[model samples]
Target chain A: MTPVPDPSEEWRRLDRRTVLVTAAVLTGVAGGAGLPTVLGLAGAMPLWRAVTWVLAGAALLVGGGAAADYVRWRRTRYRVGAERAELRTGLLLVKRRSLARERIRSVDLTAHPLLRVLGLVKVRIGTGENAGGESTLELDPVTKAEGERLRRELLDRVRPDAPDSPHDGALAVLDPGWIRYAPASFVAPLLGGAAAGAVMQVSEWFGAQGEVIEWIGDRFQDTSVLGMIVVLVLLALLAGTVGALGLWVEMWWNYRLEREPGGTLRVRRGLFTARSISIEERRLRGVELVEPLGVRMCRAARVDAVATGLVKDDEDKHADHKTLLPPAPRDLADRVAAQVLRESEAPTGAPLTAHPRAARTRRLRWALGSALAPVAVLAVLGAALTPVLLYAAAGCALVLVPLAVLLALDAYRNLGHGITGDYLVTRSGTVRRTTVALQRGGVIGWTVKQSSFQRRAGVLTLTATTAAGEGAYDIHDAGEGEGLAFAAEAVPDLLAPFLKPTGVRDAGVETRKTRG
Target chain B: MTGENAIRDEVRLRPPRNAVDERAVTWWRTQLLLTTTVPVVVLGVLGALLQPARFWLLLTAGAVAVAGLAATAFFPAWWFRVHRWEVTEDAVYVRTGAFWQEWRIAPMSRIQTVDTVRGPLEQFFRLSTVTVTTASSKGAIRIEGLDHQLAADLAERLTRITQDTPGDAT
Candidate 1:
């Protein structure tokens, strides 16, 4: 028999420099963790003794981490075979997992600052299944060139006869002027709140809480309590603005949206950490125009792609892989959205059919109920316990009632739905109004819901079930006949077989049927 | 006149044509009995052992048991009347829930997988639950309490039909 070539020879090891990267990372981690430990220990014991203990612990931690990573690197072997990309990892358990080559949908490349310096990138091969980590193959710290090659090899299924579209190249790029919109976002207030909390927490950590409080009290001693509070709030807001600006830059620096040759839209961004996220144009169902309250006031909107298989990883829940463009001018957003979907005009910008008046009444009721709930609670407590709470309750109602009513009216006004060629569009929400244009063809199912109360009101909610995006987008509180008709028209035969044309019957029967 | 005309032409979603196997009512009763009474009984025993003098806790447990028993007696039959499933050549239709009613329709062309699941109780009752999954996360239609053999055949048939159909089912 001919000598059988070793099967293990075909298996490739992870980069040898992974050990170095691991060591460096471990050192950084040790330093970060050791400082706090040393500080805490220094108070309990002598400073030099604490320092020496921490240094020894840090060395041990780094050594242990590097050794573990070295063992992991030695054990981990991956092979991109003819049919499957297989990875065999773990020491004792020896977990062997494989993903079919054809099923692979994305090959993202990311490089943090350290990885960038080392000329290495992490390659994440995903099947785009919502099935957690099982469907992903992660090769950490692969050479940048290797990552690029792997990405190309996996995603190189371009149709030979694909027509060259006019908008095939760079679709959009970062504009420095966009930073002006950063502070206008809700992030500013959130960051400001976080900054205030952090200041208190950090001062407490350093045992300087009392001193900081005294200093603040001294600074504001000249002013009245109200004026002091106002100044402090303004200062916090200024700090928040700066923080939000920095965060925005770090997140969206060098942002570029490009439509590649093989019908893929690639988004490349980040400053210290580079990310290359690719979305196959075929998987794109539609686009959403998101206008948050503050952003809306500034006449700007963000465009997000509605694509299948863009599930967030369990480990990286905050990673938003759907956004194609940040908050920009509304007209520019519409234009970019149109270009992204390859339509003459953005479907999201199309005039929508306004929801019925009863829908508005329902929202008003809900808003009034919500606004009244806390006041009612306070009033009850005041009657039972203290009279001061009654005054508080009244004050709250004065401020909250009109605000709730305004919001209710805005929400009611925002409710709309319509069909625009191949896309069925729906818009809703007030604080964060979202206009979704979903591909009519992408809808695979429909769910129609009607509560007993809704039956009385002659309204229903129609949910278009799609494989893409949030899976289901609702047309809420529409006239029963109108909603059903819309569903029937949106997807031809899906809902037709279930519907029966009948003369208006007794409402009692319908309610009883629902209850039963 | 046009508004009235639109209302006149409107169609309402009727319940799906088929009801599940009748055994589902008994199966649901048994399941609910186990789920509800187990906790109440455990709490009653623990209360009696730990604090024999605290009579109100035992009374509370007794009240919960009575409520659970009432629900076990009536809810299943009501649910049996409401829950429905019908598979056509084009789509799978289902109507489910009691107070907040819902009608779901999933097209065959978009169906991703079909499975027959038999839990311990279902197996004991010789029943099966046929789960029809579409690409959409919200579009998994479960037809509970079908005859085991019938569910298997349905699952097999669906698998064959879906295999013949093209596209990524997205």
Candidate 2:
């Protein structure tokens, strides 16, 4: 996307980038220093010093990055003199991407605690006449007044008091500290990243008999041979844990599951970083109320979507990309689902026919058992991994075994989603709860699958695809009989438009009721 | 009037059809033979290089390689599967996929862009393939099975269809 050339626009844009660079550089240097300090204790100090000196030299080279960013940022300004919001930015290589006022879809304002204190808010404006190309363009943090002005200017035609968008809804509840500080959330990351950082810090120790460290250090530059290998492995694990925490934290805060006053419903969440999103009311996608029997006992169900992008933490299916919320409260899930789905009742279709009693669920145990088999397989995967496990020490192995088991148990949960008529709602999640509000209009297609095993168990899995693109937003698992029935029967009713070569719908047609 | 007539001439000149990169089919067949079979063959011959002493251990990698190689044999067939595209009154469906079914359907209305691409291999083959990416998902639905001239003709047809805008959702 190009931005127009405003005289000095580059400098202003770079200024914003420069500040972020400063923050990153400061964090990296500080974060890097901690590593060497710890590695010194691991009996590799002398070698570590040499490795650090090289790194410190490299950091010096990038010292001007922050300054460069500042220059670029200071030069940028929105030339809103007339018909367009001329976004002129970039430095050495310039770009100008302009979005006319008429193209504005919605204006969203977001602020973190830091941004709030700075009296600045970041705004994202969704535009583009169709789903193609940049759906949203970001505006650098602006003061509240400027943000309001921009909002007013762009959305002049839209109802100012729409009241039911993602930003303004009864469901937009800020999370309390208790949910944020959940022991599972903090303990895992603290133990993981800190222990890893601590372990690496010792690996660079340049102390007595450091010749081996010297040899490895001398082998690679731009990287110490040992440091690079060790740090990269740690980073991989760290990244994975970071991702898991991201999902955990995102579910914890700004966790709003609301039925907007407008016919659409949205579930917006994030912990440190948040997202403000609104779906087209008529574009509610196919949904599933999955009851992973194991997570059910724990009262947790993961509600993801069949979205097109690469996230939302469910297994990658075009149908199930975004996890609607971590886990939310039942009463709240119902209210939000009812509103979004236009259902008279909130979605509560858990294994209603099969397991009449909630407490006595074997499915939870069954799901847990299958999930745990992978752990055993991983453990038995020894030949390729013997060196790694041998370092654990036998006693630690005994303790680690039980921890994995307990966590697996906690993950067991049961949930379901059903589309009674035109509206589709799903109930899921354990520790936190989630219910998705989907409609026939949002979905693009239907999919039905039944394993020979499922037929024997009187189960059928249904996956519904939506126009949301890839991942779970496209497909999701549902209870067998009900799921397939919904797929072959209910889905055709919902997505009948796409099925026709000509997408023109019959006039005066309302939503078709659930054939299921 | 002059520009319109010239464009009309170019449109009419587009050939009816052409075929996908036969070289791509040939190259894949060889790559399949090497990566899939080479390692297993080496492991089978060497004791230390072999997998565990379990009953089917030696055969496991080799078995997987064989299945993979078998699948690779059909790579060209799979990759160049879409030689036929009939835009019907009902819908546009292209049959692809090896095991699980893949029938890409793009109604005339949702068609966004009609493009042609030639990867390095296809360039060598003097082949340009057509891509009909719709507003459905992420990437466009590409039909590489078309012959080069046919690809150009189909692209023009698609472009014309999109331009017509039939008024009532096409």
Which candidate number maximizes DockQ? 1
Model 2 collision count: 103
CA lDDT scores, all candidates in order: 0.85, 0.48
TM-scores, each model vs. reference: 0.91, 0.56
Clashing pairs in 1: none
> Distance from true position, residue B156, model 1, in Å?
3.2
- Which candidate number has the best lDDT? 1
Q: Could you tell me how far off, in angstroms, the CA of residue A394 lies in candidate 1 after the best superposition?
A: 0.8
Per-prediction fnat values?
0.68, 0.02
Query: How well does candidate 2 score on lDDT at residue B27?
Result: 54
Report how far off residue B74 is in candidate 2 (Å). 7.9
Candidate 1 docking class: acceptable
